[model samples]
Target: PSSGNKAERFGTASVAVLVRHKPGRAYISPDHPIAQEGAGVVLTCSAKPPGWPVPQYRWFREIETGDIKSSVL
Candidate 1:
């Protein structure tokens, strides 16, 4: 009976558990009226949690034919 209790405790002790977490992506986009054609415009984009390093940016234009043009900064 003592041996059975020891075995149960050993079995429980041998189990291992772990937890992990990863940072999520942070991104921002230009506000509405992003730009106006044939007029002076400023395209602005930024990342949240200020001071993120080397963030990538992309701008898209919607056309009548459902096509998109991508611009990078």
Candidate 2:
């Protein structure tokens, strides 16, 4: 079959596999801090992406006893 006919046949098919290629891993830092823990301390994380779901974020603080305090938002 000619290439044109094959293309037409595929187009007429009921089901098709459409592959969408999208970029990943976007990171940004705002000029102003989102929050302040103590005096002269600030924390922030930012990013922008199209058609992306809400990301899972985690924050960790290391203690003197080699233990980690984790906070997830």
Candidate 3:
């Protein structure tokens, strides 16, 4: 009340937030690389994540045939 000795009020509130994530894709630099005999080559690989918890990567060498390719040690 305007003229009352004291006045008080009650209040309540709520809030929310949402987070989403998606899988990652990987790519390699120098898409197609080749090295000469008695020479060495260096390649870099990376991945992009749409959300938190960054992505990790592993590398494997692939050998190619006339019409097919396979990963080898």
Count of clashing pairs, candidate 2: 0
lDDT of model 3 at position 16: 72
lDDT of 2 by residue, 1-73 (tens): 6676443333444676655544355554556556656655445544454223445446577879998866543
What's the lDDT for candidate 2?
0.53
What TM-score would every model get versus the actual structure?
0.40, 0.34, 0.40
Alpha-carbon lDDT, every model? 0.54, 0.53, 0.65
lDDT winner: 3
Residue lDDT tens for model 3, 1-73: 4776777999999987655565478677789998898998887766665345555555555446454344532
Point out where model 1 deviates above 4 Å: 1-30, 34-37, 70-73
Name the regions of candidate 2 deviating beyond 4 angstroms. 1-23, 26-40, 48-51, 70-73
- Give the range where candidate 2 is weakest over 10 consecutive residues by summed lDDT: 45-54
Instruction: Rank the models by lDDT, top first.
Output: 3, 1, 2
Task: Write model 1 residue lDDT over 1-73, tens digit each, in one string.
Answer: 3665443333334655544433245544444655566886665665453343445566777778987756533
The CA lDDT at 18 in model 2 is 52
